[model samples]
Target chain A: MQRKKSRYIVSYSILLILICVFVLLSICIGSVTISWKEILNCVWGIEKERTYADIIFQIRLPRAVAACLLGGALALAGYLLQTFFHNPIAGPFVLGISSGAKLLVALTMVAFLERGVKLGSIGLIVAAFIGSMLCMGFVLLLSKVVTGMSMLIVSGVMISYICSAVTEFVVTFADDSNIVNLHHWSQGSFSGTTWSNVVCIGVVVGITFFYVFTLAKPLGAFQMGEVYAKNAGVNIKRFRVLLVLLSSLLSACVTAFAGPISFVGIAVPHLIKQLFQTAKPIVMIPACFLGGGVFCLFCDLLARTLFAPTELSVSTITAVFGAPIVIIIMIQGRKK
Target chain B: MEKKEYYFHAKGLKVGYKKKPLIENIEIPLKKGEILTLLGPNGAGKTTIIKSIIQQLEPLGGVMYLDGEDMFAMNRKTLAKRMSAVLTNPIDTEFMTVEDVVGTGRYPYTGKFGILEKEDKRVLKESMELVHIVDIAQKQFSEISDGQRQRVLLARALCQEPDLLILDEPTSYLDIRYKMEFLSVLQELSRQKQVTVILSLHELELAARVSDHIICVNQEGVKGFGTPEEIFSEGFISTLYGIKVGNYDEKSGDLELEAKKGKPEIFILAGNGTGSALFRKMQRKRIPFAVGVLWENDLDYPVAKALASEIITVPAFCRISEKKIEQAKQCMKRCGRVVTTLDLSILQDYGSTLRELYDFALQNQLVEEK
Candidate 1:
C-alpha cells in the first residue's frame, strides 16, 4: 500500500512538472517568440503595450489554456467511452462524435456566413452538441445490432468517414473572407482562440469534469460489467444516460472550439493508464487530464513552431504522435 | 402440510426473457438460512430463473415475496443492499486488484464518490478472509486462476453483507476440489451468517451433498422441490435430466452411462461389492458378462445395475436359493470362463454352495479365473 501510494505521488509529480514545462513552452516559443523573463514581465505589467505583451496576453495565452481545457476534455471523453464499451480503441474521434460535432459546426458556420452573420462561440458549441448527440444515438443503436466490439468500432469509423466527407464538402464550396478563417479552423488548430472562448470552454468542461469525477466510484464498479454494476446498486438506467450526456458534452465542447482533433481521445487515456498501471478512476481521471493537457500543449507548440511562419494543423501533429499508440493498443489487444 | 411460514416464497412465478416464458409455475418456499440449489440440464432456464430473481431480467409474471414483501416492488437500492449475485459470465477486468474487486460490493453504503470508510474496508477484508482469498488480496484479478477468480467473485458478493446471495452456476468451470471448496464456502457463509443462498449447480453429487433444499427444473417446468431425501428418492433426477444414455443412481448419488449390450459369455460369482472395476473394464472392452448370487444391498449394486448385461440377485441378507442357482446355471451355459470375487470368510459361510459352483465350472470345461 505504501509503495502504491508512492507510485501515484511520483506519477502525479511527473505529470505536474511536464504540464508546467509545456505550458511555458507554449507561451514562450510562438511566432515573435518571447522569453520567460519577458513573458513574466508582460504579465507583471512592465511593458503593457509592447508586442510581447500583446502576443502573450492577447493571443497565445488563450490558445494555450484552450488547448489545456479541450485536450483534457478529449481524454476524459475517451476514458469514459472506453469504459462504456469495454474496448481499448473506443474514443470520441474514432466513434465519430468529434466528426459529428465538426459537421454540424461547419454547417452552422456556412449557414450563418451565407446570411452575412457570424456564429458566436455559444451557437457553435450548441450546434456541435446536437450533432454529437445525434451521432451518439445512432452509435448506440448500431452497438445493439452489431455482434462484436470490433464491428462496433468499424461502424463508428464508417460514421466518422461519412461525417468528415460532408464536412469537407462544406469546406470546399463555402468561400468568403469568413470562410477563409472557417477553412483554417476546420483543419483543427488552437490558433485565434480569444479570452471569451477560453472562459466558455473552461466553464462547460469544468462542470462536466466535476460530474465525471463524482462518477469515479460507480464507474469503477461499472468496469466489472453491467450485471455486476447493477448488482452493486448502480442505477443502470440513470448511470448510462449520464455517461452518454457527459462524454458527448466534453467531446462536443472540443469540436466547437478547435474543430475535430483526432487520436488524442483514444491515445492519451491509454498512455496514462499504462503509466499509472491501474485503471482506478479516482487516480486516472486527474492523471489523464494532466497527461492529455501536457500532450496537446506540446503538440500545439510544435504545430505552431515546427516550420515557423508556416503553421501545421494540430490534428496532423496529434495524428503523427497519437495514431501509433492506438495501433499498439490494437496489436496488444489481439496478442492477448 | 404447510404449517410453518417460509421466509421466502415464489407463487406461480413465470420466469423468462422478453415476456416469453420458458419455465412457468415455479413455486418455491425457502427458509431464511437454507441453501437451495437448482439442478437442471443445459438451456433448461436455470440461469433465467436466477437472473429473474436477482432482477437482471424482469420476471414475466410472478409475485416473489421476500420476508413477506413483494420482491419486485422493493426499491433496487434496498434490494441491492440485501442481495448480491455471481453470474456465470467471467469478469474480464484490467488492473483491478482482488481487494478492489471485492470492495465494489460496498456500493450501497459508500458516499457518492465511493470513498471506502474504515468499516467498509474492514468488511472487505473480512469477506476476503472468509473465502480464504486474503493471500491473493494484492494479485491482479485477471492474472489469477479460474478457481481463485471464483473465490474472489464470491468474496465480492459476500462483501455486500447480504441477507440473500444468488449465484448462477457458480461452479461451472472449477475442478472437483475447487467445486467442493466453493460450495463449502457458501455453506459456511449461509450457516454462520444466515445468508440465504439460491445457486444453480451442475455437479449432481455436489448438489445432493450440499443443498438444504433441491429444485429440479427442465424444459417442461419445475419437476420437483423438496429436501434432498424427498427429491432424490423418486427417480426424478434421471427423468429431469432425460438420461437415456446414462443412469443416475438415487441411492448413492452416482451416475453411469449404459454398458455394452450383447449376449453374456462369461459368468462371475460376485459378493460384497468386489466386481465393480472389472465390470467397468468388461463394459469398456464391449465384452458381455453376467454375475450371480449377489445381494441387492451390496456396495456395487448401482454400478452392476447400470453396466451388467445380466444379473441374478437374491434378497439382501439371505443365502443363495436353489431357484437362483438354477437360473445362474442356465444363464452361464454359453460362458467359457468363470470369475469369482470370493474370499475365505464367504467360503466358510457357504462352503457347500462354493464347492458346487467350482465343480460346475470344472465339469462344464469353463476356465476359472484365478
Candidate 2:
C-alpha cells in the first residue's frame, strides 16, 4: 500500500512536471520564438520586445491552455467510455463519437454562419453534445448486437468513416465565406482557439471533470464488472447512463473546440494506468486528466513546431505517437 | 402479521427472464447461521432463482422477507447493506489488486469518496484473514490462480458484513482443496457470525457436507426441499438427474459410472473394509467380478453393491450358514480365479466357513494366494 501510494504520487508529480514543461515550451517555441528570459520579462511587464508579450498572451497562452484542457477532456472521455463498455479500446475517437460531434457541429456552424449568426463556444458544445449522443446511441445499439470486443471496435470504425464522410460532404456544400474557418476547425487543431473558447472549454470540462471525479467510487466498483458493481450497491442502470452522458459530454466539448483529436482518448488513460500500475479510479481519474493534459500539450507543441510555418494538425502529431501506443495496447490485449 | 420463523424467507417465488416464469412457487426459508443450498443439473434454474433473490432479475412473482422487511420493496443500496452476492459472472478488471477488489465490498458503508474508515479497514482485513488470502492481498486479481480468485471473491463477499449472503455456483471452477477451503470459510462465517447463506452448488457431496438445508431443482421447478439427510434419501439424486447408467450412493455419497455387464470372470473372498479399492479397480478395468461369504454390514458394502456383478453373502452380522458356504463354494468353482482380500492370519477371525471355502478353492487350484 505504501509503495503503491508513492508510485501514484511519483506518477502524478511526473505528469505535472511534464505539463508545466510542455506549456512553457508551447509558449516559448513558435513561428516567432520567445526565450525564457523574454517570457519572464513579458510576464513582469518589462516587455523588452512588445511582440513577445503579444504573442505569449494573445496567441500561445490561449492555444496552449486549450490544448491542455481539451486533451484532458478527450482522455477523460476515453476513460469513461472504456469503463462504460468494459472494453479498453473503446474511446471517443474510435467509437466515432467525436466524428458524430464533428458532423453536427459542422452543419450547425455552416447553418448559423449562413444566417449571419455567429456560433459561440457554448452553441458549438451543445451541438457537439447532441451529435456525440446520437453516435453513442448508435454504438450502444451496436454493442448489444455485436457483443465481441473486436466487432464493437469494427462497428465504431465504420461509424467513424460514415460520420467523417457526412461531415466532409457538409463542409464541401457550405458557403464559400465560411469554408476556410470550417475547414481549419474540422481538421482537428488547437491553432485558432481564442480566450473565449478557452474559458468555455474550462467551465464545461471543469464541471464535467469534477462530476466524473465524484463518481470515482462507483467507477471503481464498476471495474469489477456489472454484476459485482450491482452487488456492491451501485444502481448499474443509472451509473451506466451517467457514464455515457459524461463521456459524451467531455468528448463533445473537445470536438466543439479542437475537432476530433485522434488516439489521445484511447492512449493516454492506458499509459497513466500502466504508470500507476493500478486502476483505482480515484487515482486514475486525476492521473488520466493530468497525463492527458501533458500528452496533448506536448503533441500540440510538436504539431506547431515540427513543420513550423506549415503547422500540422494536432491530430496528425497525436496520431503519430498515440496510434502506436494503441497498437501496443491491442497487441498486449491479444496476448492476454 | 405472522411471527417471523425464518431470518430470510421467500414464498411462492417465480423466477425467469423477461417475466416468463421458468420456475415458480419456490420456497426458501432459512434461519440465521444456517446454509441453504440449491442443487440441480445444468440449466435447471438455480441461477435464475439466485438472480431473482439478488435482484439482478426481478422475481417474476414473489415476496422475499429479509428480517421481516419486504426485500423487493427495498432499494438496492438498502438491501446491499444486508445482503451480498458472489456471482458466477466473470469479472473483467484490469490492474486491480485483491485488496482493491475486496475493498469494493464496503461500498454501502463508505462515505461519499468511498474512503475506508478504520472500521471498514478492520472489516476488510478480517474478511481477507477469514478466507486465508491476507498473504495475496497485494497480488493482481486477474493474475491469481482460480482457487485464489475464488477465495478472494469470497473474502470480498464477507467484507459486505451482510446478514444474508447469496452465491451462485461459487465453487464451480475451484479444485477440491480450494472448494473445501472456501466452503469451510463460509461455514465458519455462518456459525460464528450468524450470517444466513444461500448458494447453488453442482457438487452434491460438497453441498451435502456444507448445506444445512438443500433444495433440489430440476427444469420443471423445485423438486424437493428439505434437510440434506432428507434430500439425499435412497436413489433420489439419481431420479432427480434422470441417471440411468450410473449409481449415486446416498449412504456414502459415492458416484460410479455404469457397471461392466458380463458373466463373472473372477471371484473374491472379501470382507470388512478390504475389498473396496480392489472392487473399484476391477470396475475401472471393465472386468466382471463377484464376492462371497461377507456379512452384509461390512464397510465395503456400498462399493461392492455399486460395482459387483454378483455377491453371495450372509445377513449383516450373522454367521456364515452352511447353505451360504455351499453357495460360495459353487460360485468360486464356476469362476476362473479366486483372490482372497484378507491375510491368512486375519482370515481366521472371519469364521471357519471362509477358511473351509479357501481350502476348497486351494484344492481346486482357483485361489491365487499372495
Computed on alpha carbons, the lDDT of every model, listed in order, comes to 0.87, 0.89
| Model 1 ranges off by over 4 Å | B1-4, B345-347, B350-356, B362-365
Write down the TM-score of every candidate.
Answer: 0.97, 0.97
Q: For candidate 1, what TM-score does chain B get against the true chain B?
A: 0.94
Question: Evaluated with TM-score, which candidate comes out highest?
Answer: 2
State the lDDT of candidate 2 residue by residue for A147-227, as single tens digits. 778899999999999999998999999999889888988989998788988999999999999999999999999988888
Candidate 2: pairs in clash: none
By summed lDDT, the worst window of 10 consecutive residues in model 2 chain A runs over A46-55
Deviating ranges (above 4 Å) for candidate 2: B347-350
How well is each residue in A201-296 modelled by candidate 1, as lDDT tens digits? 999999999999999988999999999999988889998999999999999999999998999988999999888899999999999898889889
Clashing pairs in 1: none
**lDDT (C-alpha) at residue A175 in model 2:** 92
On lDDT, the leading prediction is 2
